[model samples]
Target: MPSILLCPQDTAVFTREYLNGWYSLSAYYASKLTSDLPMLLICPTLFTTIIYIMTSQPDVFARFAMCWGVSLILAIVGHFMGLAFGSTFDLQMAILLVPGLSIPFMIFSGFFIRIHELSAIFRPLCDISFYRYTMEALMQAIYGYDRPDLECHVEFCYFKSPSKLLKELDMLGDLYGHDSGITN
Candidate 1:
């Protein structure tokens, strides 16, 4: 009635069926928008203004939705998160985020340079470095350096290369048992 160009009689049937199929597909996708995806991402993309107002208010609804809502959908229907995301966290290192000596341990743990490289006066400081623990853990994770091989290299490398100090410590570790400590 508004602007009919009067297609051929057979074409009208095909056109009507095409229109119905298109409408059905749009409705199917529209229904999935709520149950299928992250509401924050999907809601705004599907309806921009509605997303803006709901997000602007900053309510508990947003918080709960973040932790629970989408994950629930994933659990029930999609990826079966029960099997997918179990405990991959390292509780030990997480605990060591703080250590006993605290201050100097962080300073000495060989992050910037190895601790064996530090000055002789600061050598005693190595006894308390958490950096040493972190380096030892890293090295042990790769391959454990035996106790003195671990110790003197850590000391000399604070200023010099730990590899060279490692050689010296190899000699020392062979000569001395676990108690030699770091001498000048």
Candidate 2:
């Protein structure tokens, strides 16, 4: 959303500057991207740290790192998506379109419906949905690698077993690398 505002607000200035031969297109793009890098890295790191601590998640460093990494990547992707829409359309249209397009991805993120449960016609959509990959990667980081069972304060905790929860989510596999597009 920040990038969305940036594009519309900067488009006129960029066009004028470019036309006046102040800088080349590549330079302008490079500067814009680099300027956002610090915000991209720092915001996600701080947000992930706060949430990870507040949620009382596992005390494992690897798990925390994975979550933070995924969060940072997601933030960058979302920023670029907004930037694209903002550049392509007017402010109002971009504002409407961002959430309009995001709803489907959210629906197919394996939270509302399992990827396996999705119909064949909609399978392609699930494949393209970053949310699915994000969810899978996060789940793997938090619960996979033979992690131990959760401490259940209540006597009847159904998903104290991470494997069971993963299975129910249709994410019980060595899919962390696949989801993250990184091989071990």
Candidate 3:
């Protein structure tokens, strides 16, 4: 979502391509936005629909809506990135910068790396990641205490309940109690 959809558009809009063009830059961006609308809608709809159905999760519509909401947010972030940065090269640099920024986010996403084990310095950054909220909400929806129990080997017996495992990783939150009208 960083610059994949908007980098070329950014280059076209910010450079001489738009300088000699007839349309205003804002109009150009508007057109660019319109051009991307279909894929944005279609891809997320299909993606979320498929994953929700195939995975057979409870609260199907909620998960679909949450995933779509995240897709839209990330798409908007990418679109604004094109508007904010000056060049495709800068966008590329921003792409590289993303992994550095995102690695901490990913680590704190409560999936791969354990949030409790992380040093305190990264706590603030973890909270800042857009992925954090979505992951939290998704996990809350799919793995709350009331949901089905998980099975594991003797050494992994503690994972019998998803909420227990989440608690062990410091991924549990008050989000479950607050009906967010989407994932939670």
Candidate 4:
């Protein structure tokens, strides 16, 4: 939302400045990215830290780092996507289009529908959804890589075993590296 609102305003000023030969295009772009870097890093780190503790996620530093990294990447991608839309269209149109496009991505993200259960044609959408990859990586970080079985208090626990749960989710393989594009 910040990118969507700010990028257009920045572009207008940038265009005028560039036309007046105030700075090279590359310099302005580089400066803009550099300025935004701190906020990008800080916001995700804060958010990940709070949520990681609040949700009672595993205390392992590596797992927390994985969640934070995935969150940071997602934020960067979302920022760029908003910037693209803001630069390409009017504010109202960009606002409408962003959510409109996101609905399909969310639907295919494997939270509501498993990829294996999806239709063959729609299965490809899951492959492209960043949410799907993020979810997979987070799951793997918290539950995969030979994690022991969860402690179940009830007598009839269906998914006490992390491996069994992953298998049921059709995410039994070690694809953390592939999913997040970072070697695990």
Q: Candidate 1, residues 16-99: lDDT per residue as tens digits? A: 865777546455435434544464345434443354346442333433333233233323321222111211213343223323
Best by the TM-score measure:
2
Candidates 3 and 4: which is better by lDDT?
Answer: 4
The models' CA-based lDDT, in order, is 0.38, 0.91, 0.63, 0.88
Instruction: Give the TM-score comparing model 1 with the true structure, all chains together.
Output: 0.24
Descending-TM-score candidate ranking: 2, 4, 3, 1
Clashes of 4: 0
lDDT of 3 by residue, 75-98 (tens): 565456544542434656666665
Off by over 4 Å in 3: 1-14, 78-95, 145-162, 173-184
Off by over 4 Å in 1: 1-103, 144-184
Quickly count the clashes in candidate 2.
0
Writing each residue's lDDT as its tens digit, candidate 4 over 144-170 gives 988878888999999999999988888
Candidate 1 Cα lDDT to native: 0.38
Candidate 3 achieves a global lDDT of 0.63
User: What are the per-residue Cα lDDT tens digits for candidate 2 across 1-184?
Assistant: 8888778879999999999999998999899999999999999999999999998888999999888888988998998998899999999899999999999999988789887887899889888899999999999998998999999999799999999999999888888888877875
| Worst-scoring 10-residue span by lDDT in model 3 | 175-184
Model 1 residue 79 lDDT score: 23
TM-scores, one per candidate:
0.24, 0.95, 0.68, 0.94
State how far residue 114 of model 2 sits from its true place (Å). 1.4
Instruction: Please say which candidate is ahead in TM-score: 2 or 3.
Output: 2
